[model samples]
Each structure stands twice: as structure tokens, then as C-alpha cells.
Target: MKPINRRSNAPVFWGLFGAGGMLAALFGPVLVFITGIAVPLVLILPADAMSWPRMQAFAQHWAGKGLLFVVVALFMWHAMHRILHSLHDLGVHAGTALKFACYGLALLVTMTAAWILVAVGF
Candidate 1:
């Protein structure tokens, strides 16, 4: 019998990571259902609906918010990797420029999320 080759796992890893993030997003609703608490639907609605008390509750529930952050950050990292590589493949080969642009965007997104999480006291 021939041995299985396992080199083509990058796509598999990315797919699983992305799916996990989606699941985490979905889990928020499940939590709301179980707890009978109306958490702000950040994933589905605009920031205007997010109130201070809701934010405080969200932050206080460490597990859910931490899971949310993990999902978002991982998804962002994976997306940035894929996007930068795709741009490079298209011959946009200013390596330093691409690197800085991608990293800067990622940082901005992360900071925004962090601020929201903190502002909500989560």
C-alpha cells in the first residue's frame, strides 16, 4: 500500500479556522436563547444598538467575549495572509509596501475591536 501524502493541508487548515469563527459568531445567538438575555447583536446589527449595560454584560461574561475576539482575530489574520499573497501573485510586488499595508489594516481592526471590548467593559 502507498503511504498518504499530507502536504496539501494549508487550505484545510484555513477552512477549519474560518468555519470555527463562523461557529463562534453563531454561538452568540445560542447563548442569548439559553440565557434569555438580550445581548447586543454586534455581528448582525449596527453599533447604534449596542448599549452601555449590554456592553458591560458582554464584557463580564469572559468566555463568550473572549471567544468572539479569538474568532475575529483569527479570521482577520487568515484573510490578511490570503489577500496579501493574492496581491503578490497579481504582480503587485512592492513587498515592503504590501507588508505594511496589510499589517496596518490588521492593527487598525484589532484596535477597534479592543476599544469596543474595553469600552463595553468586557
Candidate 2:
């Protein structure tokens, strides 16, 4: 049989998943420790570590915006890919429509994050 050739855009999603997983591995625990335990328990970081004004100021900074955007957007991409694959594994098999919905939601959230970050005023 002649090789049945198919082209897929999976690399893009896989790249996002890989990058996001790396980032999540690096930052997720730190975030949980800081926000979840440290801040709440007032153990290591100050309790106001995530206070509104301080967070607003951080969001207004260019570097902070970049970091926030990358974290939020990449995480969304990672989640969408995982959910899409899970649906496939479950035999949902909705094809392009499902792909559009998954990635579209991630894109929508990413854009919303960018807009909110910009609105925070640099």
C-alpha cells in the first residue's frame, strides 16, 4: 500500500504542551507554596504578597505582563491539548470542530488576558 500521507498541526499543540509543562513544573509548586501555603499561613513570604495594589503594580510592569501572558496562555494551551486528546481517547472523535473549540477557547482566554494586562496601565 502506498504510504497514506497525512499532515497534522499537532506539532504546534505539542510544542505548547511541552513548553507549558516545563513552565508549570518550574512555577506551579512555587506559586502554590507562596499563594496557597506561605501567604495564607504567613510563613515565608509576607501575607500581602498578593495584595491587590501590589499585584496591580506588578501587572502594570512590562516584564510582569510578559510573564503573566506566557504563563496564562501556555497553560491554557496545555490544558486544551490535554482535553482534546482525552476526548479522542474517549472516542469522542469530533475532529476539526472539536479542535477549533479547544484551541479557540484557549486563544480567547489568551486574548482576554492580554487585554486585561494592558488595561492594568503600565
Pairs clashing within candidate 2: none
lDDT scores in order: 0.64, 0.90
Give stretches of model 1 more than 4 Å off.
Answer: 1-56
The reply for model 2, stretches above 4 Å from the true place, is 1-3
TM values, all candidates: 0.52, 0.90
RMSD of each: 8.3, 1.7
Please provide, for model 2 over 1-122, each residue's C-alpha lDDT reduced to its tens digit, 9 standing for 90 to 100: 97768886779889999998889889889888987899889997887888999999889889999999999999899888889989889999857889899999999999999999988889
Question: What are the clashing pairs of model 1?
Answer: 59-122
Best by TM-score: 2
Q: Candidate 1's residue-wise lDDT over 29-118, tens digit each?
A: 765654443434445555544566765676668775786676666566556766877888898774778767875676677677777766
- Overlapping backbone residue pairs in candidate 1 total 1
